[model samples]
Structure formats: C-alpha cells, structure tokens
Target: MVLKRIFTAIGVAAAAFALSLSAASPAAAVPVDAPTPVKSRIEAAAAPDTAAEPRTCRARFAENVNHRLRAEAGSAILGSIPAGTWVQASCTRVAGGEYSACGLSSDFWMEVYWKGNWGHGAWGCVQDWEYTS
Candidate 1:
C-alpha cells in the first residue's frame, strides 16, 4: 500500500511539472531562422525623410558637446563646439528615429555649419540635448 501511494504521488508530481512547462512555453514560437516580421514592419513605418523642412534656432553648446557626422551617438566626431559660441542651427528630426544626448530633453538633430579654424563650409550634427537655444 505504501509503495502504491508513493507511485501515485510521483505520478501526480510528474503531471504537475509537465503542466507548468507547457504553461511557461510561449503560445506562438517563431523559428530561429525566420526573420522578425514586427521589427521589419516598425522600420518600414518609421522611415524618415531627408528633405524634411528644418527649423532654425540659435543654440549654445553645452560644455562637453561635440559635433558629429551623423546624429547617432556612435557616429564619427567632427569637432567640438566651443562653449559660449552661439551657433545658428537648422534642426531636423532624425531619419527613422530620435536621439537624446547631453541630458537635454529634445530628441532632434541640429545641423550646424562649421566655420573658422574647425573646418570651412562643413556641416555637423548635434543632438538637441547638447545645446540650449
């Protein structure tokens, strides 16, 4: 009788474990080799225009802000914007995305024309958070 009771308890435990595993499994599982449909859809829907109308603003760079070739934080750094140098910035939304930098609340990129000793007639991108208008 004791052996039979042990066997029944073991069976119940096994069934409970199986039920827990099935409940933990995702309802719909995508194959590992398959492309992610949602990510592609989001990217397609968030594509930004390069020719969007830019807003003009005069901004002063923060103490540690540098100019970048692209709006992304990992882009190539062109040069540093000197503190107290008021730059005429043409602000535009980033293509397909937004960026935050220098602890400011804006997510736009400001294109500033580089002049003086830095580089002549070159444009650089600064995150909106890195500057104050």
Candidate 2:
C-alpha cells in the first residue's frame, strides 16, 4: 500500500514540474491580441523613354498572312489577316536578319490591329513586306 502511494506522488510531482516549465517560457507569455510583424516589397518604376509611342499607318495585305504573337515566324499565331484587308499597321524592325513570308521579304514585323468581335481589338505581328503601305 505504501509503494502504490509513493508512485502516485512521483507522477503528480512530474506533471507539476512540466506544467511549471511550459508557463515559464517566453512564448507562453505572449498576449493573444498582439499584432504580427508585416513585410513590404518595393518595385522599380518604369522609364519614360522605354515606353513605345502609339504609331499607326494604313496598309493592305497582299496575301493571307498568319498574325503571330511575337516577331519570329515560328511564334504562336494569334490569328490570320485575310488578303485585301486594310489594317492599322504599327511596324518595328526586329534586328538580326530579314525574314521571307507570304511571298514577301523584309526585316521588319508589323503590329496589325483590326476591329472585330474579339476583345479590345486584337493585335498580332506580320512580315512588313507581306503588306503594301
């Protein structure tokens, strides 16, 4: 009977010691309403000269040409410009070398925009020589 009582006393003492240690830690004293620290990030501003000017020129497609998302021929074709369609062309020469497509050769790629049901009047690239200004 004495041995059982001694074992029960030791177990109670161990539990009390563990509880006391947890309460003494700094993390346990933090208030429940305390605000957490916040982190912020900054982004670089855009330069005025880097922005492209809104340039528009009228041109007619000599033949059907694939309107690409990028200046390169192998890029994704956003749409196709039909022959005889007058497009508002804003062209810029892509440096490297000339490219031939739609029975024309030129080093420039024109950003063609047309009015249709497509959102915001879709824009795409076509070889400069493919259309006559």
lDDT of 2 by residue, 38-76 (tens): 211100111246446554455455567666666665667
Per-model TM values vs. the true structure:
0.37, 0.40
How many steric clashes does model 1 contain?
0
| Candidate 1 lDDT tens digits, 33-125 | 764232211112321365355434555554446666776556677787776577665443343224454443333455665554222111122
lDDT of 1: 0.48
- Candidate 2 global CA lDDT score: 0.49
After superposition, which runs of candidate 2 have C-alpha atoms over 4 Å from their true positions?
1-55, 91-98, 115-133
